[model samples]
Target: MKNTKAMRHSGPSAELEAKGLHRLAGERVLLDNISLSVHGGDRIAIVGPTGSGKSLLLRSLAMLDPIDAGEVQWRGESVHGRDIPRFRSQVIYLQQRPALVEGTVEENLRQPYFLRAHRDKHFDRERVSRLLSSLGRGDSFLSQHQRDLSGGESQLTALLRAVQLDPAILLLDEPTAALDSDSTAMVERLVIDWLSEMPSDRATVWVTHDDEQSRRISNAMLQIHDGKLSKDVHERIR
Candidate 1:
């Protein structure tokens, strides 16, 4: 089914639109004619039962997965093969599991800067430290080995690195899924703070089934069902 709400063309309108988008893994249809518009500054929480293609939607938006049909337009431009790298660099994707490399926390944070874009610049330890502290983690975490860190700790560390890199959009797939209450709260606070401090041009799309968590972090909600976006709803009671 096609989404009637999908924007025909994108411009200054504060929405990210998709048109007739579809994806498949072999004969299995992962998504079918899915369309939706996510406005600038929108914190969209994607919710649904398992196997509903929520993660697939996020991965497609992040340009990590190729679309079999249709187009995803950001500000009136099509996101295609050659543009994926640039799109991905600007739009960071956090997987369900933190894909942390085997090393110290500091090493992981410094990894991105090693890329050509940031190679010549120095790593801002102060900024990194502040992010860690914001997440209730200490400077000592920098020297701790990734393998030794707990699930919550690793997630926070991954988040810290993502923030330090400062992407225009953040795509989170159940970022706090494995966290304890304290750690989840800390991570949630950090996300809220980041969203508040960032400019309107920045956006975040978090995929989760936790209703309470979604209410805490998002202003809008989008549900996925059977490989399609169900509807959009305001988060706040109005």
Candidate 2:
């Protein structure tokens, strides 16, 4: 299936973008010809009811899911094949429930560096400790075993792992859903601080059900309903 509208390529290219994206489960549409552009410094919040295809959209943008129709581009070029690993490294996706290795928090954090995509990068203890400090965690937090961590702590560890990799774009799927207010604030601060460190080179797209969080984290908000974006937000984003 093809989108009726032409794919957009004109104007300044976005750091990440979807052009005429579509996904289907049999005959039912899971995503409806979605097109969006995310530039550096963008903090986008996607808000919607359950089953609105919000997670599907984020996964598609990360290229973690196959699309029935459309293309994803990074820096104006179509991403494919050998380029996917690099693309995934730069655009990291964090699901609602983070998966951690069966080891200490520090071990989990160090795991990504073992990947070929991040072979040139080493785990930075000092930087991670500083970030832990910002979250009110002592250096010993790293020594705690993953099995002993609470939901909030696991989420923090997961966030720390991703941030330490220094990804250019973060696709957050309700990262703070399981946290209390204080922990949520810490997550927000950590993300804001990371983006501030590279304002013109980093961006995030957060899928959240909390209206307050959407207002707090995003400069732009898009609403999805029944697998389609609201008309107003769709026009603005396109």
Candidate 3:
């Protein structure tokens, strides 16, 4: 069944919106006039050929990269000044390649809470262990060095860190790109379980080149091509 709230023709407004977002590289336009809305419970998949600005657009939405023009608004208010840090805390962006710390995975997971933005939150070992267990890992996995982890393990660890943060919006930029088929499926299951945990409050914007993967994970689809977003894209899965 389709999520009627997401497909509503009227009523509630978007949770996040990028108004007239424009980016240029000297003479070339990277993201041109990109504007879209992300509503509550929206699982949006961004699809396009390589080098088509999908990741650039995701960063733009995350407010990590400075947009040359336009603004990103969360719940109708613009993200600026002091709001940046708090906004980022609520809107977490995970790249394809996650950077782990020099220490063990457990230490790397503990580091985020020490950051200024996350100081109020304490690391929960029991909760994280449960999360890891759901992804076919054990408590011992946490003690393993980052160097010992495979591509899939690293990705899982990164995702566990993100999920523990409990961000309202998750921006995933080809997170499973480097993993094998089994690992990719495992990642998808992790995401599904995470999303199901807070179906009404959280949403994810996943960037993937696989059409089947996109269809499996997303309720809506957006195509980015030549710095522009095509509006007439949908996958009817009713």
- What ranges in model 2 sit over 4 Å off? 1-12, 234-238
Write down the worst ten-residue block by lDDT for model 3. Answer: 1-10
Pairs clashing within candidate 1: none
Tell me each candidate's TM-score.
0.88, 0.92, 0.93
The 10-residue segment of model 1 with minimum total lDDT is 1-10
Off by over 4 Å in 3: 1-11, 235-238
Query: What lDDT does each candidate get?
Result: 0.77, 0.86, 0.85
**Judged by lDDT relative to the true structure, which candidate is superior, 1 or 2?**
2
Q: Give me the candidate number with maximum TM-score.
A: 3
Best by lDDT: 2
lDDT of 1 by residue, 9-89 (tens): 222564456777899889988887887666557777888899999999988877677889978776668877666666666
Candidate 1 wrong stretches, greater than 4 Å: 1-11, 117-122, 232-238
- What is the alpha-carbon lDDT for the whole of candidate 1? 0.77
